[model samples]
Target: MSAKDRIAVFPSRMAQTIMKARLKGAQKGHSLLKKKSDALQMRFRMILKKIVDTKSLMGDVMKEASFSLAEAKFTSGDFNAIVLQNVTKAQIKVKCKKDNVAGVTLPVFESYQDGSDVHELAGLARGGQQLAKLKKSYARAIQLLVDLASLQTSFITLDEVIKITNRRVNALEHVVIPKIENTLMYIISELDEMEREEFFRLKKIQEKKKKIKAAEEQLKQTRRAMGIDVDNDGPNLFAEQHDEDLLF
Candidate 1:
């Protein structure tokens, strides 16, 4: 009755057939899930590498952006107020799409420019060169941030999916399939025992029939030797009349 010992199944040929089918299905499922786990692990490693590289670049990108902002500030007065006044709509946008990897759906983020750059002309009036440099540095930083976010999200998702897949694989491999096989072995052994019992019964019946036939043949031979009728139509096998036992 233990879960690992055997599955709850009837001990019959039909039950054995069913268990075989179930074992096949479990094995196939385990194989597919194992492959899926491998795929997810691979993706997780790639994402981890990307995150590490992106993080390493993050500090430098942020430093460059800060230096550009400082240079622009020193060259001219506060330009943030001017930019805030001119800012109306977003020129940069992110769109999401589903990416499938070994049956798992992952959301992929992509950044794109939706509209023309707003600051193309702002630098023409004052600190033109420094403002342009600052804009470039910040744009680079934003792109890096977007990439990092995408990598981190994928990493977490893959990690969770891999764990689930491995659990399923283990269950099918170690528990479900083994239990089904044990049930099959039980069914086969029971069937073989039944067949053996039937054979023994039939053998006993045949032996009894042979003994009956031999006794009838010996009786016929004894009647003929005693000079008694032995023909099938002459008399019964058991003679009842005798001169010595007759009394009138």
Candidate 2:
């Protein structure tokens, strides 16, 4: 918005004081937002780095898990039967929590070992050794997935918060601050114009008083030349001149 459009027009000392206070507040807000943006940006970079590392690690874990599953299927004539036997209960459970990073709360997922002996039953069958190895590999994959989920969630949350903070900072720096400063200049200029007008008005009044005083002094001089008393509290020259003209 333009400065004039953004500012309120109030040309008075009270308005000036209020505007100054508002300007101070805007400046303080801008400073705080700048600091907040800086902090969030720092955290965003850290989270981004972690996400990259986690993704790379996830790829490796997924590949290992796939290879282990294939080996288990080759060694155990019926790997599907083993999976069915072990499908009774989950061995890992996910718990969710919140973590605060630079004023932004992010979700964190953790995996905990659940109470289930399904893996032990899977080992009771043929090729139980390969089945066990496959189970361990899958367990490692689950743990990595949980960690990756947490990192991904935190990364997205931080990115959004950083975007919002940046918008606020830019608005204050580009729009709000300049508008307040423009309004302040307008108020000062208006007050100065009022002062100048008042000075000119007073000057005119003083000049009119001086002209009146000069006219009264000239009237006194004329009456004195006609021998009329200057301070007499009576009808003066104009009346006396009228009387003499009537007699003639």
Candidate 3:
């Protein structure tokens, strides 16, 4: 997935509650992955550039060495015998280790200069000055090859790191983040629906209670009116009893 692409999902109650947490986790993971990926890419480019430069230098050194050797052979009148006897290889020390880059460990190479050894081409009794010149040219070529080899090794390391970084970036951006977001949305939606149902149920109960309270008030008013009527009738009955007693 493109790094710029943002995810889209339905909003929900549980989703809302957990979205912040999930998003934060995803964002943190994504940021780290992006940094790693960028680092790998940068390293790869740098190494590739070095390799190109070293290769070019190597080509030049090879040409110069070949020209020098041809000159020596033409002057000596023995190409094969002279090359086989005179050409000497220099010892190289290559130090290698793993380097940490954006949490990914990769190989790195370093070259060290060792002490030089002198070798005579043949028993031709060559002059000291001529031997020194030939040795210098040969040393240049060997040094160039050493540098090129180091660059090549670094390029290989960068390639492997970049591949691993790309895979992790893809997994987080396309798979892990999406799954967490989906789960969050589901939970939030369910919670919101449950809350709405509970609110409706509470409102119904309140309305029922209000109706009962109004009915109880009406009953109390009716009882009070009946009591007033009874009081008035009691006074009238008392007056009638007084008249009857007087007549007796």
TM-score of each: 0.86, 0.83, 0.69
Candidate 3 structure quality by residue, lDDT tens digits, 1-248: 33234345456654465667777887798898788789778877887888788788878877877776666555554546654665466355667777776775665656665665434444255344444555568777776776677667667766877787778888878877876666665656667788999999999989987887787568657867777443343353322233445654
Candidate 1 regions off by >4 Å?
Answer: 1-4, 225-227, 233-248
- Clash pairs of candidate 1? none
- Tens digit of lDDT per residue, candidate 1, span 42-139? 88888898899999999999999999999999987788888998889887888888889998888888888887987788777678999899988998
Query: In order, what lDDT does every prediction score?
Result: 0.85, 0.83, 0.67
Give the per-residue Cα lDDT of candidate 2 at 107.
94
Candidate 2's residue-wise lDDT over 77-195, tens digit each?
76686467658677689999998866778899999988855557664657788878887888888898898888888888888888898999899999888888888888899899999
Model 3 gets an lDDT of 0.67
Q: Which candidate would rank higher by TM-score, 2 or 3?
A: 2
Error of 3 at 164 (Å): 2.1
Clashes of each: 0, 0, 6
Candidate 3: segments with Cα more than 4 A from true spot: 1-19, 76-90, 97-99, 112-116, 120-124, 127-131, 222-248
